[model samples]
Target: MRILLVGDEASLPAELSDYIGDLGEEWQVQTVPDGNAAISAVATSSIDAVIVAPVLPDLTAATLLGQMRTLRPETIRIALIDANASHRPPSARIIGMAHRFLPLPLAPEVLLEALTSLEELRELLDSPRLRSSIGRIEKLPSPPHLYLSLMHALEEDDDSSTEDIAKLVAADPAIAAKVLQLSNSAFFNNGRAISDLRGAVTRLGLATLRDLVLASEVFSAQSLSTTERNALQARALTASRLAAKMLPESSAQLGATAALLADIGLLLPGVRNEHDPAEEGDDRPGHAEAGAYLLGLWGLPMPIIEAVAFHLQPQRSNIRSFWVTGAVHVATALASGLPVDEQYLARVGVAAKLDGWRNSANDLITLPADA
Candidate 1:
């Protein structure tokens, strides 16, 4: 199998590459820093499968996967995401239908299963029903052209002007309206409404706006159900608030992005779907693993990817970076609602000191919420 792995996480690439190498001559692999580069590589090369982390240094996994489907529809995609936190309904809807999602803590068995699943997807690729499914999936829940433009504007060099970003937001009335609506939601709750894109941009800041653009594209009316929609809104709002309070010293801008999309794994119909009676083993395998597989397909960053993969299995505990997924775990659980198990909290405490998986678990438990 020829695989293209796009992510900058120092640890995951090494581990994944080594694992593929151990699979012997049948498996070949290549690595890239972000989604855009991954797209270029795919255009010029032959890739059998693609694995991506959601929160990349330069681009998001969902954006990249959307692009890849346009360039090469045949390649199987697998997302690597953190599962400890919850995600919004729209993003979760996007992820649920992905070819595969692998979670963090890198269980060799699950990783192998994900790889094998790609082989299954490839076999089914030519089927008429499968082809139709892929077609619908390829259509994208959001308007892709507009989304890519907004992403480019927000992630431009720090010296880039906010005016350029404001112009991008202005270009899309629907997107602009969504942003303003979100800004005025009880979550943002600025005492007064400004009624303009510029005001929304200024108050939310570029990073928050960037995150919202991606979110709004997904959350369009087609994406939500009563329960799934409410869960996403609750998780996004709560996680963002808690992450801000917890990671005050950290400069990484994905605090809100991480929180808002944290529980995306749950929204996937595959993971949440009712179990088949014949399949006796755990129906979803693991929510985090399912999410990671989907995120990997989208080509997100390793940090966000890992957080999606390992949100539930804190005990699995082998993450490569603390900045992204670990922080996500701490902030996500606080936002989602605490575990019913006291022992779970104590276990989290022990892991906090031993594994250093973001000490915020302690504070998350203590404060619950900040004034």
Candidate 2:
């Protein structure tokens, strides 16, 4: 992995060098004093990732990230900002530009975690067959008109209101319905129901509603059959809600989004391999792998792609923590009425929590009938 640091971190080079040396060959780090040099390196070299500081001498981090996105959409872009940096751009704007928003005076481990995520994602998805499957896809989810309108209103208008966003969503009947349905999800119940589109938009907030619009478009994308597609989508949505209930509030959104898109491969035209299930015991890739590959190709954040890739096979994750992947795996299983991997859960030290999760699922009406 070659990382480009676009900041004035003096000690970062030595610290990162010590760590990178231990990782052996194929690891490189280069630092540039300002955004112009960083852009030059990025344009000329096969840079895998770029980390920019909040304050830049020549260019704003946002402008640099935007430039990187245009140059190499596949590059994992990150912003390192100080929490106390008053001039830092709005987090929403930065998050939209960069895959991650790391804090300043960065810890080596935190940066390492970001790099390791990329490695793990490659380990899970590196396959010639998977590449061919994704290549066959003529197109992926193109943001619908309403979604574009929402983005414009948020970006161009500082005072964009919930009602204004709701109006944009409501213009497209499909997205509005999904947003309303998601807001009324069993996991998000706020005592009273959300019957109006504006109310639903308010409940979910702008960022979440924006993501859901994309998800709704993907689920409703043309596939083999509407009946089959709707079934997969409904099941996915149910698992999404269940997955959210399994994790703490901090990770719930990631868990939900990952679960919601886990079966995307099955719906995509050329991504699903019929022989995947039979070859599951081997290293053969499956729908989970294919969907993850698609997400990565689209330049999504690594954590989301990682969770989608490993949601069904938590043991393959190697890490034993109850991360987004574990939540998605168990929730998806319970939603589909498939047996949760008790052994895998036990291995992760989360087995004792399964019964409680099961009980909670039992109380919800979202879980689809035993598939």
Candidate 3:
């Protein structure tokens, strides 16, 4: 892997250099003093990733990262900012530019882990043709207008009420149905059904509701036949519920949301039926990578992004424990009538729990369509 470090040797701490050097001959590390040199190197070299310091001689870290984003969209971008600087709110521009943020004075082990994870993710999404195809897409789905409005009201002003967001969600039947369905799932429902959208919103809270709406909007934007759309939604809903049930309480919400959006890449322009002759082989980009790429661009949480990217092949991830990716993988496999990978389940120490999860998924599938 080729990494570009944008900062002067004096400013770029020695610990970082020593850590990178420890990776041995397999990794090529280069350091440049300022943004101009960094940009020039990016234009001339086949850089795989970039790490930029908060302060540079000529340009700010945000400016350099933003330009690098346009210049090398495939390259991984990491921002090294002071830990104390996190007290101030980050600008939207910076958030959109850097794929990952590492507070400086970072431990050498943490930096190494981050780079290792990035390399694994790159391998999971390894397809130049698919990257080119996604880049040329002119009409990728946008977040629902209601979602946007709700986010605006919540972020820009404090006057937005739960009732107001609930009403906005109710205005769209598709989004409303999804919210109610998730609210009544085994994870949220406590015996009684949530008959109203307002009650559903209250149960789910604003943050979780927003993610569901975004996922629903992407589903709605796809040009799918009713049967295809319904089948996909059913599988997604089942997978999401199973994932929530299997995860720990703290990460259950994120796991469910990731599973729900796991299949979104199937809706991308060039993607078609898995059995279609043109896409019958592994040469084409699968739904997992495409969905992850789009969501990454939309600035979704990194865990959710990683889950969507690696759900199809969770073993590709560097983390050894059961995380959002593992939950989604197991849930998706069960929902699609495929046997869970016993080795993976054993590796994660969740093999014995598969039977119970399968039962939960079966019950979810048997629920009333409008339930």
Candidate 4:
């Protein structure tokens, strides 16, 4: 991977260069003294990621990263800021620009984890065609304003109880539902459900819920018609619940999230492979890869991404045992009123459990509809 480092030569991390060199021969790192230099480098070459320091010679970190938003829109951006400074706590806008933030004088472990995530995403999205298609995603919904309010309330008021936070999210039902969805998913919860918004907020605490609420922005279905949006939401909600039932305790949360977000790609334009005839036949089916790509880009866990990416084609995955991908495939098929892949299931070692799984999904047909 090609990386661009932006800041003063001294302001940047001291051992960062040594760490990058240790990553191996395929990695290349360059330091740019200012925002203009960083922009020029990105424009002239292919840089997979950029790291920013608090002080840039020509521009602030946010300004440079904001410009990079268009220059290499898909490139990963990380900022290392001194949280202890008097003028600390960057604005939400700045926080939003960098995919992840690290304290300045960065720890080697934190940097390694960030780099590993980048490399893993690259490996998961190895398809050049898919990468090109994802690049055309022009309409990423802005981070929700409600989330900003939630963050402020949680941080500023030490007395703010879980109920207070839940009240804030509940004020916007649209955002509240998303909170519950993520809370119920394996990302936040253990294996069981957290049905209420307050419970979700309480379970997620301050930091975890902030990430979930921000992640919820992609769930916005404004691009869809009322009819399409409602139908899809109903299906997703039911599928997520049923998926939770199908998976074992250890895997339920991831399964629910995968099933819920499996169709999220349908909300974005240019998500389908326009030039690839094989993927052009049906947009709905193609949504699996698109949604997975989008989630992968958002830095979700690999299991969730893989589950959504191959929901319709579970056989594409090595089915050693029943897990997130299998649960999502079964639940989504049942929710959509389609037949499960019996032939595939017969070989998956879960054919006997199919009866119980389908029985669990049967009640989902009545869940959000005719209530």
Candidate 5:
């Protein structure tokens, strides 16, 4: 694997190069001292991944990463920032550009693990046919207009009210319907149906409602057979609910959101519909990566993006502990007809917890009868 290190740090390049060299001769590490050189390298080289410092000589890390995104959309991007940098949150532009953030006073093992994880994920999705198919997807539908309006309002003023957000959502009938449906779904378990947009908005809160808007917009963008759309939506809701039950409270919301959008790759242009047996023999890109690529472009949270990307093969993830990817993986398997990956579960040391999760998932009403 060819990894690029972009920064002007005098000592970092040597230290990182030495550590990466220990991984084996198959790993090639290149160091560039500034953003211009980094961009030139990416444009000229087949770099697999990049680790960039927060500050670069010619440009900020965000600008460098943004250029990288345009030049090499497939290359994995990691932000290597100072540990103290976490005191202030990253700008939205930076967050949108990088796939992962590492607090650096650097740990060799952690960096190695991140690289290894990216390598593993790449291996899982190495099919040339899949790459060709995904490459053909020129554009994805943007988030709903109402969602954009709500975001703009919130950004223009820190204290946008729920009423204002709800009013915006209500202006779009399709979005309002989706918000109401989700609010009343088993995932919420509110005991009574939510018929009003304002009530649904309050029930879901701004963060979750925002995620739902993105998901709903993506799903609605394409024209699908009613059966296929319904099936996909039901499975997503089931997986999301199960994910909420499996992950920690802090991460559960993001996990659910990830699960909700896990199969979005299926909607990308040129992908065959798995629901149609006639399309079984057709070559299509893996839905996980396609979905992640779209979400990454849209600047969703990295956890949600990674979870969607790796849900199909959680064992490839570098994170050893339970995470959104694991929950979504198991939930997706249970929601679909696929068998849960026993070996992956064992490797992650979560095999013991599966049966209980399976039982709970089975009882969820969102699951289809066949599932």
Candidate 6:
């Protein structure tokens, strides 16, 4: 695995470098003391993952992630918080670029686990099933210009004025309309009404607005049977709501966007029948590969694209990626009415693995829509 560690502190960088070196000869780790150097490294090389610190001399991790949006465009970006940072992982911060949040006083074991798990996931993804699924899948939809523009704007420094953001939102009527609809969706549950695009943007904020815009952008690109489409939508809404709850303070908008797009591979264009008895156990293909391929094409952040691409293979994914993938796994399973009892969940990893997910299983299972 190739990793880029960006921070100003000499000690933190040294600590991280030592831990990564323990992973051995195959691991290639690079350290950039500041965001500019990090951005330059990303622009010049291929990096699998990036670990960024929030407070750095030259720039904050947030600033680096924004620049990275334009630089690598596809790398998974994670925030490394000082175990002691005063502010929590604010929702807006997570929305912008953070895929994973690691508190400082870092443990070598946990760090190694994230790296090892990442490698294993990459290997698992190279399987025959994924290859076959990718071959069978159709095209993926691109985010509309409005959606892309907002993402780019959000990645900007404060110099990116609000008027610029408002203009971007105002340009696409269809995207704007969907943004308003989603803003008013039960997810937001605004007691008061949101009447227009500007109102939606105001009520939702740029972070939330950006997320919904991307969601609507991808929703327009899929083709699915009514039943399958409805199921996908239900799972997405349920996942989005759960994501809001689980990651109550984290951004990962792309993660939420992945939640909406995760099951789309199940909507493969040429598959005539999903329930045909003969098709069962055929194992000719699966959803992960198709979804991953589609997301990769859409320029989604890698963690989200990978999670959507590999949610089913729990044992194959690394711990950090597992957090997101596991959440999606349980959310989708609950939304689909799969059993979430201890025994069933044990077989599923999530039922036994994630405390938050385990505790919420019954409530999630019994939700009016999912039930």
Q: Which of candidates 3 and 5 reaches a greater TM-score?
A: 3
* lDDT, each prediction: 0.58, 0.71, 0.75, 0.71, 0.74, 0.59
CA RMSD of each candidate after superposition: 12.6, 8.8, 7.8, 6.7, 8.7, 11.7
Reference-based TM-score, model 5: 0.58
Candidate 1 residue lDDT tens string, 1-371:
89888887652557778788789898898888887889999999978778787678877777787777667666776676675531212364445334555665456666676776555433322233333334334333322334556664446666656666777787778778777777676656669986877777778777667666665554443446755554565556556555555454453555555555566544444444221233566433344554454444444445455556655544444543344455556667655555422244355443433223234434332211111
Candidate 2 residue 264 C-alpha distance from true site, Å: 0.8
The stretch of ten residues in a row with the least summed lDDT in candidate 3 is 272-281
Q: Which residue segments of model 2 deviate by more than 4 Å?
A: 1-124, 141-160, 177-196, 203-214, 273-276, 279-284, 367-371
Tens digit of per-residue lDDT, candidate 5, span 324-350: 888989998888867787888888788
Residue 40 of model 6 has an lDDT of 82
Candidate 2 lDDT: 0.71
Tens digits of lDDT, candidate 4, 32-83: 7899999999999988889998887689888888888777766877777785
Off by over 4 Å in 6: 1-124, 127-139, 143-145, 158-162, 184-193, 225-231, 247-254, 271-283, 320-322, 340-371
Cα shift from native, residue 40, model 1 (Å):
24
Candidate 2 clash figure, as a count: 0
Q: Could you tell me the lDDT of residue 91 within candidate 6?
A: 43
Off by over 4 Å in 4: 9-11, 60-63, 66-74, 79-106, 142-217, 273-285, 365-371
TM-score of each: 0.54, 0.59, 0.59, 0.73, 0.58, 0.53
Q: What's the best-to-worst order under TM-score?
A: 4, 3, 2, 5, 1, 6
True-vs-predicted CA distance for residue 150, candidate 2, Å: 5.9
Decide which is better by lDDT, 2 or 6. Answer: 2
Record all residue pairs in model 5 with backbone atoms less than 3 Å apart, i.e. clashing.
Answer: none
Task: Look at candidate 4 and give me any clashing residue pairs.
Answer: 186-253
